[model samples]
Target: MKLLLLRNFVFTILQSGTVVGLIPFLIVEPKLNDMLTQQLKISHYLGMLIFTLGFFMMLICIRSFAIDGKGTLSPADPTKRLVIKGLYKFSRNPMYIGVLTILMGETIFFKSYQLLIYLLLIFIAFNIFIILVEEPRLRRDFGKEYLDYCKKVERWG
Candidate 1:
């Protein structure tokens, strides 16, 4: 149990760094004065609030995967059981939604059109991956139970 938790925690950090940390650096340099590239006039407070909400959403989904699914979110160490509790009840892909939400918040906060484009590209890629890979694997692994859950939950909400 301790080993599992440690593995999950380490993988979670790596995944979060890749998705929520490194990607942003590639998209845009954080700057106090983004006057040259600023495309939106979103309030700073609003951006922070959105970022906080996104972070919380991701945390909840990660916790659900660890506790209820008895697994980590990493593809190499995926859930052992089908998880349909919490945000999963609302969206079959809440984890993706949470990541996209974080990207959206970054877009607003950075006021970077490049970041916005990156976010859209990421969304499209995730949609394709879910449709072509993840969903099929779930159907195969969990069979009728997964199909039923798919019927109940929106892919993204």
Candidate 2:
């Protein structure tokens, strides 16, 4: 059990960290001077708060995946059971929402048009992937239970 959780955590970090961490850092280029000045701005604080909240949201979703679903966020190591607990109770794709929220926070914090564009692009891509790929797979995998859950929960939160 510990080994599986560790594996899930590692995969979540690698996959989500690359998307929400490494890519944003490349776009942000957070220098000390600019960072110092930005600290005083309201947008900076707001962004930090949103980012922190989004990070926590992702962590909770990851925990749900590991504990309830017995898997990680990676498709290669997907949940054996459908995750309909935690944030999942409210939204079918809370994890994806968490990723988008993080991107939004980054765009706001950095005040970068490029980051905004990236966020928008990722949003569209996530929608497409969920509709065409993930949803169908979930339906096929979990059948009636997943469909019933879908009926009970909104796709996004």
Q: Candidate 2 — what's its lDDT?
A: 0.86
lDDT of 2 by residue, 69-88 (tens): 99888888889999998899
lDDT of 1 by residue, 59-133 (tens): 898888889998888888989999999999999988888888888888877777887898899899999989998
Q: Which segments of candidate 2 are over 4 A away from where they belong?
A: 30-33, 36-39
Alpha carbon lDDT of each predicted model: 0.83, 0.86
After superposition, candidate 1 runs with Cα above 4 Å error: 30-42
